[model samples]
Target: MSDALDRRRLLGRALAFGALSVLPGCNYDNLQHPDFADRALRAMSRWNDRVQAALFDPHTLAPTFPASAITRPPRFNAFYDEAHVHVVDGASWQLELFGNIAEKRPWRLADLRAAPQESQITRLICVEGWRVIGQWGGVPLGWFLRRIGADTKARYVSFRCADGYYESIDMPSALHPQTLLALDFLGKPLTPPFGYPLRLRIPTKLGFKNPKSLVALGVTNVFPGGYWVAQGYNWFSGS
Candidate 1:
């Protein structure tokens, strides 16, 4: 929590330094469709997100203890999906993929499991400055991207969620070796509230971008605003 707060403070300082003030009196929304102020804010937020990644470069990780060092019970911040049923019940769940090279397709859990898998028992460092060591078991996101033949025209990948939340990232983050669509934990199926069937785990980014109850994956060249971004929060939320 303190860490997230610190980042918030840093963001304020950055914005002040940049002299990117909200328009006075004149409503940005009323000025034009999509609005210049809104676009400027989004760009500033994306730039701010790079701060954390620059802070932590782990060609060699920091001196932290092993998994056994984690306290008995992990802290839960309750950022799980506030929408959608606890269980997907199979039949209705969908992971729709749309990209430039291929027609759209919907995939379910079974289809996900059938793809190539990658497991990494590494750190999950939340924006709140807390860290957890857990083994993520699931198919690599690259597997899906490859299946859909993500194209050169697509520079970003967006996660559309059933939770009324959305998140996005550039090709570099999406293709990071550790990125996964985690579906299991501690050798068992993920609990209902812990992004059950799958969630994007981009370890280098803050947990906020980890979209739960994922509904669709859209590949696009333009960067779209995320749920938090639309609500006056940084779209990148990285680190």
Candidate 2:
């Protein structure tokens, strides 16, 4: 418990520094003032998000690598150890869609496999500073969103995972060309440890933004805070 508290405190301080660095003329000398500090951090975080979004170029693409650049025996990461990885039954798995979508129907694995497929060899950079290059193939999120008649202008696209992890991304990032509903990894269907059946494979953001074993997706204007974002990480963590 002490270790968790220490990590949270460290993260809080780092975010406070980020807030101070971006917003000039802000006073936060008294760390004892929790209320004031919390308010300042919230405001600064939102401001940082706006700045990042404004600077993001929809036309620009993340750098991609060749097949040879793929990481061998890809690294497995999650809140749980590999031994505890959730095993999703691919045959029984169905993607549920709701909120601002005209087609509320569930999508089966066959449906996704039959859709137009795109593949990319890209890097997945973790916030912890490790990165791995891998090849992923799946449906383009932009095309899928349009096909389902989702509100393209919606502020947020939220995802619920099989392992209880949840995340959200802005509409622009969701519609980015590199954003994919990844079905295959390393030229084959994903194994249980790597989010089998369906996972998001967005190269534009950090690894956590690319949720695995996606069960439900929703489009909404309401702010859908992610697992890590709720724990103080920046919401718009653009790579």
Candidate 3:
């Protein structure tokens, strides 16, 4: 609906600056391999596949929680640029999709929410060593794929966040009945602090796997990057 923010230039600058200012405990390194700099970008995407297979491999779930528990929200692990007027102001928000998707797209939040919807109470685990059970309601990603007429070749769906986060998931994870593009929270409109407008919920993985304040979807066969992976968190974070 809106134009994609050409943020590569500015975001690149910020990432460069971050390499120095990362807080004391942060790794500030890309898994530091001899070939690290040359192929560091694939960390998150590769991990995404590993976890996806573990979850919906025509097998058991990665892990599932009981409905008796209600999540009270885990420690916020997002990096939101409140000042990013493009998302905060809602004047410039676009969602992109590529890869085997026949209908290349750029959708607005309103458009994404208008699609089919579903809900569930699931446990969310964070890589920071905590978990929370929460009720999430949103549209199933399969609806989006069907609408786009995705071909078999399309294996990975990539989401880029407004805060400069990237996450990729395999085709099954993208189409999983539980994977939702959430528009509401706890029976109320999601606030900006909690990935307002819209976010993705991949119940099978840690909370960090879900990208918040999402702006674009690039469906591709290639593994895309993720925020934590570039920082040395296990790319295939599935335990």
With a 3 Å backbone cut-off (N, CA, C), the pairs that clash in candidate 1 are none
lDDT of 3 by residue, 47-119 (tens): 6656547665523454555666675543455644445523454546667766677788677767867788777
After superposition, candidate 1 runs with Cα above 4 Å error? 1-43, 49-74, 78-86, 101-103
lDDT of 1 by residue, 169-231 (tens): 766667666778888765566665666777787776667777766878888888776765555
Order the candidates by TM-score, highest first.
2, 1, 3
lDDT of each: 0.65, 0.87, 0.65
* Deviation (Å) of 102 in candidate 1: 1.1
Top candidate when judged by TM-score against the true structure: 2
Model 2: per-residue Cα lDDT at residue 59: 86
| TM-score attained by model 1 | 0.71
Q: Write the per-residue lDDT of candidate 2 for residues 1-239, one digit (tens) a residue.
A: 65554444412444646655355443334323334455667689889999989988898899999888899989999877899988898888999998999998999999999999999999999999999999999999999999999999999999999999999999999999999999999999988889998999989999989899899999999999998887668899988
Q: What is the TM-score of each candidate against the true structure?
A: 0.71, 0.88, 0.70
Model 1 / residue 78 / CA error / Å: 4.1
